[model samples]
Target: MKNFKILNNYSIRSKLIIIYLFCVLIPMIVTNSIVYITIKSNEVREQRITMEHAIERVKYNLSSVLDDCVLVSNHLHNDITLNDFITRRYDNLLDYYERYNYLLQNNVINYYYNSQHVYQVTIYTDNDTISNSSNFRKLTSETRQSEWYRQFYNNNEDMTISVYYDDNRKNYGINNTARTISITRKLDNFDKTHENILKIDVDYNVILNDILNEKMEDNLYVCNKSYILFSNKKSNVGTEEFDTIDSIEEKDVKLNDFFRFKVANEAWNIIITANEVSPLSKIVERKEILFGLAIFNLLLPTIIIILVSHSIGYRVTLLGIYLGKVENEEFSTIEYNDGQDEIGKLIRSYNLMVLRIKELIEVVFKRDAEKQRLELAKKQAELKALQSQVNPHFMFNTLESIRMRSLIKGESETAEIIENLSALLRKTINWGEDYITIEDEMLFVENYLQIQKYRFGEKLTFSFYVMGDCKGIRIPKLSILSFVENACVHGIEEVSHNASINVSIFKYDSRLFIEISDTGSGMEEDQLNLIRDKLRNAEIDMLNNSKSTGVLNTYMRLQMYCNNNMQFEIDSKPKEGTDVTIQIFLDEPGVSNSFVKENQNNNF
Candidate 1:
């Protein structure tokens, strides 16, 4: 359990190596070792059994071949007719021919010719009256000097096996020296004759062919003690005299097995020397192939495991890095090519979560900013109310007294001017309402323009145009009056020539359009664009930092009133005129008197 725990602690790559060693490499080595030992042992044992069977077969065939020759020789020796024919005195060649034809009819040699591998049957005798033909031969000086006859006479037994080369022989019509193996016996069954001998030649090629038929991958020798009587290799069969088995031994032949048997009173040996291949040669020859297979088995799996483990571990590590970044509040998405597997799905889900979180954070931040803006607007409203509370009753009474004094002094135009000034000051000092109908706001605009016209005299000309249906549309207080004040101060006061100011409030397509334009020494493009940018992007914070608080405040309030469904545009040309247009959809969502009322109650 402790070892298992330690193994678990190791990385996946190391664990895979351990698994290969134990599961594949070690087991394979043990299995191959056992298989090699068992196969080698079985191969050696099977070779020995095979060699034994082969040698035994060669011995049996040799014995059978020789036995057939001896059997034929025994028949000739015991035959009364054959004995009488060879021993009888013949008067003429015709009588001998007639008797020889009769003997040929019952010849045992003809019966055993193909069946017993017999080549020929010859009866040799020193009977001078008998003629020599195929079956009967006259023994002469040359016959006595032959190797077959010599070997037989030297054995000095009643019967013997003789193997020698007959140089003056023809086999199958081919004149060549051939090896002859035969059984020679003295025909003494019941005879009173000279030396009658029977010789039955066992076909040497047939015997050699029998040994060759074993189909063994080994060198075989059929030997008579020291002389090699037969060999499976045709070249090894003796030409003139039989070769000795000791010559084979001298050539460093590795003869490891022998089968000895008796045939015709002579011990013959079957010697087997293995071919150039070892019994375990198969294992030796395939050693390199086996080693390569082992390496392929080990290395292939190792590489596969490493690739699989790296693929998994690398993706998991990448996820870990992204997770760390997320923990640090870095809401960045995973910029990776995704797969269809479980881990790839996880990464895609994480990206989606990051996107949703970022959206929610933006919503929360916007809500907080709105709250701060409302609070600041409320404070500024309170400050304006406080500043407006500076002895307003006394100031009004003093203005009334001066206007009545001017009327009593018959300066009627002076009294009207003082009255307009006093009324304008009173309306400007009041902060009782945040939103009023366009009709009420236009009255305020007229008062402010009246005071400006009095200051500019004939140099300024101003007019107000309000559509019939647009008069009752509610808007933020001072939203239009602020722009009119800017026109009077910048346009009418700066120009030496007569400059005209126009204020138009009209409705088209359910939208309220308020346009304030002035014909005066118009502003440069840079100043116009600056002011336009300021008004378009107006915020509560600009009220504190910007010198143009009046215009900025008016734009911000109008935005809040229309719920940002308001558009403000500025069009101007140098030395020509300036135009400011604000378009708002009156019936849009949240663009209603109740929406402004709620804001007013909350702030005031």
Candidate 2:
């Protein structure tokens, strides 16, 4: 009946508003996230297509370079110097080259292919044929060599390609600069001597260089079976030794023989590279624009949604606040702005909480009044209870002896700090009253800091401010002390920079405030969130949870005595620092019984 009465007391409109808010909020988040992902997917697809087109271009260009070499061979075979030089001597080919200059010279292929091998018209008629030039005048049998006889002539092949390096003569080596490929053939109606052999070497350097010219901005490089010719982002060519199966400098690069991915008709492995314009960029840009617009479009509704939800959340927060304040006599009523929304209904429910509070107060008052009448009888019982207790004075005496011994051993600071701790504990734990001076808490804290001071040396700095006669005011136990330990462990432990800690206690609005701030290695929003989550779920039995749990466990114990009259707030940022303020009311619930007897004794 009482629970039904409690439910009936709150306005009906609040429940409907809460239902309406959920209807709007859930769908809005899901739809916006979906739209963002869709836009990103399309961008990725477009980038892939761009990458494929680029690969095709590299293959076509390499094919054209190979084709140019074939054209040069066809033009040379029809010339007379090729035949005349083999039959006679080097002098016999002079007029033939003059006559066939048009056929031999291709301005399009000449600029880079301008080396002697590409333009020189030479013919070797037979195995022993030697030119009558000054360089070949004394050519012996050992000096004579035929590239055509070994590679193309004897095989009766239509054509053959060979790469040759004559180390002894230092002559007629294809891509003499790099030791490369050349095309050769045997001519049938040569009329040049008995040898029907014709040898032609394609200048591979010229072809490779042509590719470098066209893509003036790409890493247009060639990697033979042995090494890679490199061009940097600036198009400067150099050589890079190949040690691995391969490594790619830029993404989507083609390494015909280097890559392990299945290839299509893959001779002449080509590598094509680009800088600012890559497949990834195009894909990302296109998708970003599409989905970026989608996400941008979602912002308006999102803002409205946040404002509405926060309003609802704020009302709930205030309701919890009102219930907490009513637990003490400090606040007896909850007044709020009128509205027909769900929050308005909640405020109405809160208004009826006043009646619940009134009934609780009456029950407690009647109970206490009866207890006062029996207080004389309880005093007799308390005397009996005291009679059975161990003497706290004896424990303090032992601790005092330890303090004196440390002092005698020349540990003056250690002795002084321990002496203070002994007194703080004796007064707080065994005191007859629940309230103690703020000044007394400060003394305990200062003594604790003094012990830490000797350990940290120069790394720690502290400040303390006390107000409202820090004496005779009861408080939640283990409130400020735990945070001090937390500050030292988390804040100062990892800091490389100079560190300082400031602990200030004061009074505002008839409340006691203890703000402990640390300057050390600060934390980012994400780190701070993770720390808070660990702190909030900690129960009193947190020692069993994990060894790392700290301030949160102490907070659970404090909440038992002070309830929500104590407020804990944390503010932190990356590389900045952390501030934890624990605020408590000086008087609340049962002020006399709330404080541990230890703090009260320390007050005097």
Candidate 3:
């Protein structure tokens, strides 16, 4: 309930801001989160499907190559010339070479030409007559102990394919740098007494490009039962070993590292490893666009809410201000469109109430107006009487100064002091004006200070530093002189030693500054603070009760005259001195003029 009351205390604008965040922003964030998750899931599924299809295509292509190898092995096994050349013992190397040439031309050449993938064909036998060449070699104990030879010999299958370095290039005096897929098969004669090995090396590049040419964003490998047979990456062709996929129960399934597809007939499996590039690259590329959309979604509603709330709040505030005016008996009607909304209806009702109040008050106001005129005249008379009271006190002080000067100088400086007193009184009684230029006011202050100088003689000293440009600026009449009078009467008179007074007038930026400093008996901190508080609060009753009425009256009058644009400050330290500073902004000349006009209209 407490929280509810707190919420109710919030303005309509605050409520609308909260509503917009919950209703629009929260839902937008939730929807965006859900959409992002859905998109990511779909992308993952599509990537899996794509990987599976690529592996399947690789398996198909590899199977086709294995089938071709089987067909070639079958043709070589049935050929009588190749089988006879391998089984029969020749008498001489020349005769063996002739028979080997015939076998190569008739059968081996035909098989090599028919298959575009075949790199070389070789037949190795126990017969020594068959000389070692690129395509014919004599089988030995060293050849039987080789890795590819042992794999082929131990396998029970008819044909086996394994990746191996082509060592036959050594027989032809060339470096054996080519890696090839070797398809090996052991052939038996009719008596099963003689055996020979038939080997076909398929070009690894041709198999990869021509057979498994379906491009994928992943690495594809064709592995034998124990080791890799061929791979799109050359580094993994023969050096890498298979990860024991031969024992897996499922023929086509996904493994931890790769997607596996097996060809049981050839004991070969296709493994696909996904690359570093994700399949959702398109979505990642639009990251900036997604962020921009999110920001737009958040800001669009907030901007709309601010504009809408401002319209309603602004009119409501206007109504409040107008109501305050009515309560003060100003009787000003609110000026706005009579809209159809609730606030508009309230405004319309307020306008009707103001009209009725104005009409009802007119008759009574007329009678009160006459009575108020008489009362205003009486108040003006009383204000003049009150203002005249200051002059008597000032005149008595001047008379006392004249009397002191006459007794001290034996009437020699009396004439001069009396003339200065006359001039000061004339300036003070010129009450028709409330404002004068800075230059004219300084002249008046000089006259007053001059009379004081005659009374104090060398005991009181004063100086004025008025900037030429600031002399034309107008300020309240007698504002500066009041502070100077206070410095002489309250500050210098209380001290016995010679005291100095400094008055400066200058302009800084758009403001005019007047500083009056006195070296006299300064008040204590507590007394200074009390006066400062009264000046800041600007309480008329406090000013009436205070002994420093001249400073208080001057402060209040300047505040009214400048509409608080003027700044007044007092700085004093006990036994050190006191400084009074006044600053008036010159940006609005009408403020000073309006003060003079209002005071004149009031007959003060």
Highest-TM-score candidate: 1
Tell me the alpha-carbon RMSD of every candidate: 45.2, 22.8, 30.2
- Could you tell me every candidate's TM-score relative to the true structure? 0.40, 0.31, 0.38
Ranking of all predicted structures according to TM-score, beginning with the best and ending with the worst: 1, 3, 2
TM for candidate 3 is: 0.38
lDDT of 3 by residue, 375-485 (tens): 999999999999887766677577777767776877857766676777777777667678777888898888888889988999999999999877766678999999999
What is the full ranking by lDDT, best candidate first? Answer: 1, 3, 2
Give the per-residue lDDT digits (tens) of candidate 2, residues 133-251. Answer: 41112323432444434544344456654434434333433334433345554444456345544344444455545455553444544454434532323321212222221664646
Which parts of model 1 are misplaced by more than 4 Å?
A: 1-39, 170-177, 234-242, 250-263, 275-280, 284-604
Q: Give the Cα error of residue 356 in candidate 2, in Å.
A: 46
Query: TM-score of model 1 relative to the true fold?
Result: 0.40
| Prediction 3 global C-alpha lDDT | 0.71
Candidate 1's residue-wise lDDT over 379-436, tens digit each? 9999999978877888999999999999999998778878888887787787677777
* Ten contiguous residues minimizing lDDT sum, candidate 2: 236-245
* Residue 81, candidate 2: C-alpha displacement in angstroms: 99
